[model samples]
Target chain A: MGRRIAQIICFAFGALLFALYFSQHPTARSLNTAVMIDYWQIIFAITLLVGVISFVRINLSNIRRGDNRPYRIISLVGLAVMPILAIIWGIKGNSPFMWMFEYVQVPMQSTVFALLAFFVASASFRGFRARSAPAAVLLTAALLTLTSRSSLEGIVPQFITEAADWVRGNPSMAARRAILIGIGLGSLTTSLRVILGIERTWLGSDK
Target chain B: MDWGVIIAGLLTLAIFSFLYRDNPAYKMAESLLIGVSIGYFLVITWTNTLMDLLFVPLTQDAKWPLIIPLALGVMMFGRFHKRTAPLSRIPIAVLIGSGAGVAIPAMLEARTLRQISATVGPLVTESGLPDISLIAVLVGVLTTLVYFYFSREHKGALGGAAKVGTYFLMSFFGTTFGYTVMSRMSTLIGRVEFLLSDFLRLTQ
Candidate 1:
């Protein structure tokens, strides 16, 4: 009895909403879907508060278990202070929330980015190995690209410019277009899944 | 001397102190940052999205249309419970069924059919050999597709084609690596510039 009702409701609502999007005529189906999308967003907003509660609960439990976690307390303090300050003052161009964003978020992101240098160095070392004919060609192109002393020399030797331009225009363009095509397909598939609700893995469950 | 710059400058120094060695100040800043981000997302969703989009409209008018997603969203919370979790299928089925229905035509047109059509054009023209760029594109498309073909072992003609694919992949990866390195260097430079230009102002 329970599952029958669930299936009936699910199929009817899903089909109606899906069809609404394709309809040329003004219909209740389209209007209902538009409203439902907005309401779903509100439910997601409530989940944010739930997330904060979860965070505090987990960290507090960790501290209680003799973890000696002072950093968790620091987190709670910032969480408490910033929201209160923002609520009191309200966020605008020069408000405290904006202040925290510019000062805090940007710096931390930059720090994580600094680690990329080390990773790139190691990856490049592996990539530049002249182990095969293709590797040799890669090494030569990379050397030319790396060593080029901008203005006058390329003008002096037409062939150098022509060769460099050829490498950039042909092989590089092809490679990049291939990448773009793959990305476009992947994104299109993802968007399709989202709109259809077929890809509910993002919801962390069947729902 | 400005208070905005001073607080930011101090925070930057505290955060970056990890470069020398990890310590209390860095840990404190990092924790505060994580906590603030959680709070910020919550507040943004409440004010910018929820209050504007859902809460006001639902209350002002009896938004019966919203009842479906609201029910679906509630069903999603069922996963938290042990026994009632199977009830989550209602929402999941709705999501999957609708999502697939909408995406089917779009994906067919945009990704599969468009790509197949793109490959069907003339390979060689009267102007000369087919456009060199087009030839490289065809090679890349053919080779990469072949590279992903796992059914047959790379031997004989397959081996030669696979070899070309491997080279294309490596060169593609190599160029990507260079671009990533340059971008990372720029990030570091930008951070240092921010510290000097926005925070300190003494370097100028």
Candidate 2:
């Protein structure tokens, strides 16, 4: 019974929004934007709260079980302190919250992202092995591209760069468009499925 | 002797230490990052989204229609209770449905229609010679589409075309991977620069 009602709401809202996008009517457009910008924003914000609560609950349970208790405590403290600092001192540029964010979060994030460079190098070593004909082509193309786009361009011939550009302009672009068109068609089909209530995976199980 | 820069430098080093092996410093730094990120998100979302968008407008402007979505949002918490878990589907459905609804038409216009038009252009050059690049692009697009087409068995000519298409696809992916490596290297370079110039003060 509840599932039926949920399906109806999904269909109604989905169809309304889908139709709303195509409508040239000012009222429909404004209403769609209002629903998205205002209502959906709040819903997504509320979902974040849900996420935080789940995080805290899981960490607290972990702490209780003595699974990495010290680390869990640090995580909890970090979580607790920032909001209190934000509320009490406010998040002015000089506030403790902002200070922690700037000094801690930014550096950590940048360093983590920087680690991807090492991983990519390792992956490329494995990927550009030229184990087969197709792989040889891939390896050759990748090597040419990397050399052309790198500081080694001075050493590499200008023709290498020109060939790389040609590859990017024609083959790469065509493949990209084909993939894009596939995605567009797939998305449209999925949207129709959702509207028609044929797709119920989002509902989870009755369990 | 700014404390912030010193702390930033230490955290940066601690995070990079994971490249050697996972240690207490890296774990602590990782946990601190996760917690701080969530905390920061919560505060920002509360202020910029909830208070400014929902609460303020409702309280000050008396925009009562906002309550419908608010109620739906609140209903998402029903998942916390076993019996009421099914009720959470209402919000989930609304979110997925609306998201898909909004995406489809825009995707059609941008990815499908625009792409087709972009591909279908004048094959002749300004000097009246047939543009080889344009012809190559047209052939590439059609053959690649054929490569993805599962309806027919690739036995003869279709197999030959699909084989060529596979090379084009491989070239595309290889270039993309190469570009990714360059960008990632750039990111690493930025961190190195920060460490040297700002943290260690080794260079200007």
Candidate 3:
């Protein structure tokens, strides 16, 4: 019964918002803005708390099980410390909170992504075996692209760069657009299914 | 001179150390990253969204309508408890439903219609010359679409066309991969520069 009501509520809100997009009524516009801006913001904030709770729960379990307890403790401590510091000291641009963010979080995130550089280079060399015609074409395109973008652009002839541009603009873009079209249509179908309650996967099997 | 630069350099080295092999430093840095990111988001959400948007409006402006979302938000925490887990589904459903509804129209307009319109243009440029690149794009798009059309058996001319489409798709993927590598390399360069210039004072 509860799940049924939840699904109904979900359908109603979705339909209402969908209708609002098409409608120009003043009341609907105000409600739409309020729901999206004010209401959604709060809801999203509450969702973040849910994430923090889950993190704590899992890390605590790990610690209790004696599985890398020290690292788990470090994680929990790091998690707990920043928010406490922020709330107590505030997170202005020059505050300790922002300092920790700029130093620790910023570098860590960037370095994490940066680590992909070595992996990509190694992986491409290992993976780009030209066993087939399509594979050969792919390898050629990749090489041309890298060379066109690198310092070798000056060393390589201008015509090669033009060819690289043509390849990127034509074939690459067409494939990308085809994929995008597929994704758009698929999303529309899935959204309609959810709105009409045809998709019940969101409703857990607990009931 | 600055502590921030020192800490950042150390963290960068810690993460890069994973290139050698997974070690304790990498593990610690990874954990710290997750913890700090979540913590940062938590505080930002509390101050920026909760205090500013919800609490202030409800208390000061007396926006009674805000209570509806507040109640729903509190109910989201019910998932942790066994009996109320079903109740939590309500908010999750509304979130998913509304998200899908919003995404559907936006994606259709942006991704599908606009892309198709862009793809459909004259084969010749204003200079009255045959636009070779445009022709290539049109042919690539059609063949790629045909390749994706799996309702019918791919044989004869269709099979040949699909083979051509496979090459186009592979070339596209390759270029995309190269571009991604370039982006990642730029980030790595930035970190290396920071270490040399800011932390080690090796270069100005």
lDDT of each: 0.65, 0.87, 0.88
- All candidates in order of lDDT, best leading: 3, 2, 1
Candidate 2 clashing pairs, residues 3+ apart or interchain: none
TM-score of chain A of each: 0.61, 0.94, 0.93
N/CA/C clash count, model 1: 6
Q: Could you give the CAPRI-style class of model 3?
A: medium
The DockQ score of candidate 2 comes to 0.74
Candidate 1 chain B weakest lDDT stretch, 10 residues:
B96-105
TM-score of each: 0.77, 0.95, 0.95
* Model 1 agreement with the true structure over B1-204: per-residue lDDT tens digits: 677667666767777777667799888888888887776776777688766766666788776666666666666666567677766666665654454445555555675566656655677878867766667767866676566566899888877887777666656655555456667777767767878988878587
What tens-digit string does per-residue lDDT give for candidate 2 at A82-177? 899999999887888898888888888989999989988887777668888878778777887899999898999889999988988888888887
> Which tens-of-lDDT digit does each residue in A74-157 have in candidate 1?
788778766786898887788878777776766776765764665667677876688888887677555444434343444546
Error of 3 at B18 (Å): 1.0
In model 3, which regions exceed 4 Å deviation?
B125-129
- Arrange candidates by TM-score, highest first: which order? 2, 3, 1
DockQ, every prediction: 0.40, 0.74, 0.74
State the lDDT of candidate 3 residue by residue for B47-149, as single tens digits.
8999898899899999888898899899999989898888788778778767776777788899889989999999998999999888888888888887998
